[model samples]
Target: PSVQDCTICMERLSAPSGYKGPQPAVKPDLVGKLVKCGHVFHLHCLVAMYNNGNKDGSLQCPTCKTIYGVKTGTQPPGKMEYHIIPHALPGHSDCKTIRIIYNIPPGVQGPEHPNPGKSFTARGFPRHCYLPDSEKGRKVLKLLLVAWDRRLIFAIGTSSTTGESDTVIWNEIHHKTEFGSNLTGHGYPDINYLDNVLAELAAQGITEESLAQEKD
Candidate 1:
């Protein structure tokens, strides 16, 4: 069977890898197949791609986005708590609300952090976030639990708002912090919040499809 081009470097599988980094010691024509997706790519290209990333011992297929190993993050230790709230959010009056609370305290950074041995400030302890208990919202919650398990919810870095170094910040995933209004631009009334959050979660490699793949 003829293998398609390597999506990572956009080169035919039979040819040498297009990776221009320090050359890997494998045969130029050697290719590797992803176990789950069965996609083949030049071994050298895969090595370069993995090196260019966080190198957290995981590989994601560029063609099908299948994750090969557990994906983790450099988020400092924290607590994630969630429960059902009786009151409904402004725009989601049809169902009850699910509130998630994240609590991370000030701590020294580790080797994986941006600055090891430096103190990182967690500005908001027990930050509150919300979502409706609808079907899609529950789906998002399930995926969110996975994200938290992988430590992808928060990270240690400089605060974009205060410009303070060695601080904790939200890691890409958007949350609605405001309870009643959209005043802070983080609140509700936006029809696309659920879908938008799903997209954000997918961008972090925490999609529902990936979750199912893990189960398999």
Candidate 2:
């Protein structure tokens, strides 16, 4: 087998893996392969990676980004409610609006968050997000539902907008919270909002490919 350097430590596969992570040392490090992706890493490095994550029993191969199990998120406790509204967005006048209501209250952080026991800010409650109730929009909604189930919609960390730490913030995906207006630039009437959000979702490893793979 052709040996590759450990991506985490930059050491040869044959060399004993080094320890430079946050975990305490106990045993000598060895190497192993992620059975699905065939990506190799030091066993210690893999354990460190897992420990640094949500510890949700799923791991992504760092090299290929292949997921071994369901990917959970660092979103705090919240409620995701959705319903159809009678109003139509600017660009899509043919269909009604699908309103998503995300309600997360201020609470202490858990082990999944950055600082456990520290209070996190929930700047907005019942934040309204919008989408068209069309075929493609419904498809996006379905995937977003999956994203919600995996808690990928929001996360607890530093707020980029306010630069506040220990706060509830949106993840990499963006949402169009404005409806029936585009004055704020966050509103619709732009023709590419749905496609853009879909691309953002894909960046987070949520896409039609994941939906197709779910059936298998």
Candidate No. with top TM-score: 2
Query: How much lDDT does candidate 1 score?
Result: 0.86
lDDT of 1 by residue, 50-112 (tens): 877678999888887777787778888889999999988988999999999999999999988
The backbone clash count of each candidate, in order, is: 0, 0
Per-model TM-score versus the true fold: 0.77, 0.84
**Candidate 1 residue-pair clash tally:** 0
Error of 1 at 193 (Å): 0.9
Best by lDDT: 1
lDDT of 2 by residue, 1-216 (tens): 126788877777787666576863434456788897788888888888888788898888888777777787988888888999998999899989999999999999987788998998899788999999999899888888878878899998888778999889998778888887988788988788788989877756788877886668
- Checking candidate 1 for backbone clashes, the offending pairs are none
CA RMSD of each candidate after superposition = 3.6, 2.9
